[model samples]
Target: MNQQRIDGGARRAVFAPVDNRARVDAVVRRIGDAIELGLLGDGEQLPGESELAGQLGVSTVTLREALMALRQQGLVTTRRGRGGGSFVSLPEVPGEERLKARLRGWSTEELRDLGDHWAALSGAAARLAAERTEPEDLVQLRRTAAELAQADEAAACSRLYGRFHVELAAAAQSARLTREQVALQTEVGALLCLVLGDGEYREEVSERLRFVISAVQDGAHESAREPAERCVRESTARLIALRLTL
Candidate 1:
């Protein structure tokens, strides 16, 4: 037999026994969720393929297929050396301008819906962070606040503001909660940048950042939730008003 034919036949033989799309998709989603929630950080090693398959209760072939999908989505990378294994790839955080462009097509109602979701999720995060934050996490939170205070340019301030929320979510120490907060922040950040791309708005945002940090530092969980929630509501209102003017 020709070498090409032999290779094709072997490939067919290898995969001919497995066919479970649902199982593969489920595994892929579980792994993707882990990545989103920072349970698996960038460049971190993953368990061996067989081990992961066993842990997830799926066949080796199904697990391999799921991993291939993750690789396609830029979520994980695979290597072949003795020390090499699958490693998580951090998803790129979108820039403020790029995010704003993406939100240009959203209707006013859609923006309101997003704001509502953000308020509820962020309020919960503030409450949880106040309750669960360790001293080290609080220190990181303070550092983020300092960065916001020292930012001299609008673009730089926007980026730091984004990081501030990410740090607060991390302080909560719940992967699921962090993921939800990150998603909401992404949307709200985009909208805020779109509506308030001026010096005045940047100052307002900076003031709000100060209040949130002070509340958290004071260990007043309920107090912290109010500023975070108000920020979302006010930003949403600003976006809606700008859209109306346009």
Candidate 2:
């Protein structure tokens, strides 16, 4: 297996049901969402078409069509010959104008709903992380938090910030929880890019992450949940505020 091939573990992190959906679209979404969440890295090789189709429970034809669509969108590239296969080619993050347009389309209630959903997932993950994790399990959590704190670019900060929640869920040692966190982060990660550009706000959020990790390290489940939820809610509030002003 190529080092960059998304292994089975990574594939499981984002795979979802395709039944009752257009097969091509479903395949595209499964692979596309994985890329968006960084489950698949840039220049990563995809599994062989037949193997990938089997894993996805889709026909090879459908999978081919999906890959073609991805190629057209520049999310993937396909080449023939030795050492050539489908490779991830993540596009640049959308401009602020795109983010603004996306946010302007959301209603207040929808914003709140997204916030509540995010809060619930993150809160539960944090609480479980405190209960289930050992001291060493938090190493990645601390590292991801630190990176988010120092990330100077909006896209870099947003990706690292999203990674913190994913790492927290993994520290809980629940595969289901981790996958759900990845899925949630895919959607919320894009939105976060809208607000994560501010250096001061990124630092504030980073400090909050430290507090949450500290609580988890101390095995304070309840304490961890509050700050974790607050961190998510605060980001949502910032996004909503920007939407309101626009």
Candidate 3:
């Protein structure tokens, strides 16, 4: 009987069969979920492949296969040296004109679906920010808001606004929620900067920032959530309209 044996104290175990590809895929999926859920973060190093494999009950080769897939997706990078490991890559924010061009190929429904997701996550973030915010966090939030207001160009405002949302998420004090909020904000801001190329639209964004700040400042968790959701939805709709016109 040719059976692979596992050596453990007093017991040797043999597994019937295992799918290496499936195992690799599972590892990839698990890591992706961790990144999405904020269990992992950009530039954060992952555990050693051998350790991860042991944790997941798989061979190192299987884990390497999964890491390769992530590398292809530009989600993770690996370095071969002392104190080096797989690290999460930061998501890039596309420029306004570039994002607009990209969206020209997407359907209205697809854009709307993106909007819906953004709204739901952002609403939750606002509520959490209001509920958990501290004085120091509020100070940072106000500073970001002020920067957004002072920005002269759409590009500048877009970046500052994105930062404002990040600060709000930090105030929320939940690592998972903050991670989701950051992801959504990055995606939404990239798209919005593209569609909202005019001063009027940016002004609207600033006004929404004001509303968010006020709600969080007053500890109005419920009020903040709805307005944040509305802001995301409204911005999405505005982008859709712009796409239609183009």
Candidate 4:
């Protein structure tokens, strides 16, 4: 993978270990998620053990255990000499056949309910972002969206597309909102990977994303919410259609 394609500030994801319960597991999961989301590139060396532990609020021992688990899972590897540390090792994304099976397992009603919840979260984030975003913060939003639009691989686009919403919540200037959006994205991001390879769907989504960004950039708060909500709804509808085809 070309790290240069994703070399931007948005790719440096911050770790937030809420409450420190099961700290090692939390460290492993967050690092894995960062890799899956394309925020951490393949071959990117992690921070030094102590520094990484501090960032995730885990002890060095806990961090070591987490890194070992990642190594076992093939998600991270360690080196011996100078300029060496644990480095990200991204796995192949699940295949379309596997994704199709996943879609088949979910009822339309269930998927619709999840979409409704996602829409509420994203819709409000877009509205708040349009209303509250500063000129400088818009840069991150545009960068993320542009990254999604330009992503050459389905796996990369899937992660970048999802990250755009999380960035919007951050742009809204509410920490709580940002956290909530991240959590929601984490939950649904895997499902999105299933359909990202479809050129038609990907193009439509790219256009919708740009519309939402334009509305936010123009400070059209009300206009931002509709396209944002519609984007969620339309994407989920396509996924549900995939369910029926299986």
Q: What are the per-residue Cα lDDT tens digits for candidate 4 across 39-150?
A: 7998999999999989888789889998997887677989989978889976565555544544554678978888998898889989989999778978877787777777
Q: What is the lDDT of candidate 4?
A: 0.79
For residues 1-246, what per-residue lDDT tens digits would candidate 1 score against the true structure?
687887897878887966598788768767765665456888999999999899999989999999998887777899998999999986575434333433454678987887788778767778778877667777876777677667665556655776777777778777887788666664455345554467677678778877776777677788889998887688778877776655
**Runs of candidate 4 exceeding 4 Å displacement:** 1-94
- Model 1 sits at a Cα RMSD from the real structure of 11.9
Candidate 1 TM-score versus the reference: 0.55
Q: lDDT of each model, Cα atoms only?
A: 0.73, 0.83, 0.73, 0.79
TM-score winner between 1 and 4, please give it.
4
Task: Give the TM-score (vs. native) of candidate 4.
Answer: 0.62
For candidate 2, the lDDT comes to: 0.83
**Best-first order by lDDT:** 2, 4, 3, 1
Put the candidates in TM-score order, highest first: 2, 4, 3, 1
TM-score of each: 0.55, 0.65, 0.59, 0.62
Task: Determine which window of 10 residues in candidate 2 has minimal summed lDDT.
Answer: 12-21
Q: Largest lDDT belongs to which candidate?
A: 2
Among all windows of 10 consecutive residues in model 1, the one with the lowest summed lDDT is: 94-103
**Candidate 2 lDDT over residue span 1-246, tens digit each:** 864567666766567544533778768766775675468999999999999999999888889999997886677999899998899987675557645654665677788888898899889989999999897898898899878877898888988988898888888888888898888777677668879988889899999999999989889888889999999999999988887889
Q: Give RMSD to native, each candidate.
A: 11.9, 11.8, 9.8, 14.1
